[model samples]
Target: MQKEGQKSSKYDFEFKGGKNNSYVFETNYDITYEVKFKPSSYLFDERYQFSSQVFEMVIAVTESKNLDDKIPPDGLIMFTIAEIVTDFFKNRERIIVYICDTADARHLARARKFGLWFEKFKTTQFMKVDASITDEMGVIYMNALILHRENPYFVEIIDAFRKVTGGYSEDK
Candidate 1:
């Protein structure tokens, strides 16, 4: 946000926490993939589909400091991303819960019942959701998965922050 007297500066690259986009997923042997919000937004901000409110997280890792080779190549982006995300959530008690995945039949089946899933993780906290939508060409390339809160604790944090600071990242 621009300050009372300061002007807004342009950013070099735009981030992807925006609204209304489609994606897919695909797999073969001992599968796993991530529904990275590329900056994971508040999971249900879109799922519940409220027009006025876009409760988002600062999911962008492409901050200048992140330009280092820490970004692993494509396909392996998950391991690096998961590490960062896990560590990030650790710092803020505000982020109450997170769900990750490992694709398998039993977990997939459970996801149909529970809503999210992580194969490496025991079926304790997360409910697995299978996102293998194959089309005529082959396996599904884009899967639009939603990571929502069965509990709204994260939302409470967002609301509280808004109440206190009104979305400005820092004081001028």
Candidate 2:
């Protein structure tokens, strides 16, 4: 039970300032994860180009050196991620786009897990919109756009995301 106005996660994390806007944290199993928020405004340029900040959030296992490692479930990981997201929203007008990795064909599962996390930890100040599409090769891509509720370009951002996703709206 996180108190209002308090950070979501009880775990500690550090922001590794670099080209990719990375944040790092370690789990109890000694597994290290790096969460990167990369600029992805180009995805919206074709639809609704705006100055509002947009980024793609990518979470990967580092240090372990093996993407196939069978890591045990760590609830703290979600807390750390929620904490990072809380910090990122300090600007109050940014958007985060998260596309699940499809290398193992578990994109849907990943998206579901992320959606659960967002539903669990998301505050009232934020909103999430989900979209899914199958590419020409029939690869399903699942993504979510998270943004601050008070963002000045809220309508534009949602409209742009809808356009980018071929008029798909989760609300509809």
Candidate 3:
């Protein structure tokens, strides 16, 4: 975690696609990505009464290729994202989750599921339901940042897990 008025955390990482080189590119065999927590809004009152902080969590799948051209399973994707969020935030509060995949656009259903799941998370955590849309990609592009709950800014990224899979999967 960062200080009350500290800047966002910039993180870069890489990992193997999956077993049997499934998620690797046809040529390359690894996935390069970045998860950045950019602070947007700080709650406070007169006298600089800083209470909680809001961050725009940005995740980028910089390099990912599949031998069979198959995107990773939703479960895997959710698990990966959940872990990333949990590890990054580590008990922080007043956070907003944002993820957009306009590059390889999937379906709104995916985003809706993530949103609903986050909504459920709000029941227990400080997350916001209005955030966490899984409809579009690159919503949190390198330059695509926004104030949580502001117009044109309504989404959240997960950084904690009450259970495996973040309790988002209905199959469980």
TM, every model: 0.26, 0.87, 0.41
Ranking by TM-score: 2, 3, 1
lDDT of 3 by residue, 1-172 (tens): 2223444332222334232111211112344445556554442222322223455565555566553555453333444454455554443543543444545555355456656544433323233433322225434221111222332212222222112122332211
Compared with the true structure, what per-residue lDDT tens digits does model 2 show for residues 1-172? 2333545445568899687789987765567788998987787784454543888999998876333678877677887788899898898777899999999999999999998998888677888999987899999899898888898888888888887887654521
Each prediction's total of clashing residue pairs, residues at least 3 apart in sequence or on different chains, is 14, 0, 20
Candidate models: Cα lDDT each: 0.30, 0.81, 0.37
lDDT of 1 at 103: 36
In model 2, what are the clashing residue pairs, if there are any?
none
Off by over 4 Å in 2: 1-9, 46-52, 65-68
Local accuracy of candidate 1 as per-residue lDDT tens digits, 1-172: 1123433231112122234211122221112222333333443344343312322222223223323434333333333334433333332332322222333334343333223213332223222222343447653321212222343443553443334333322110
State which candidate has the highest TM-score.
2
lDDT (C-alpha) at residue 3 in model 2 = 32
Worst 10 residues of 3 by lDDT: 19-28
Q: Which of 2 and 3 is ahead in lDDT?
A: 2
Candidate 1's C-alpha lDDT? 0.30
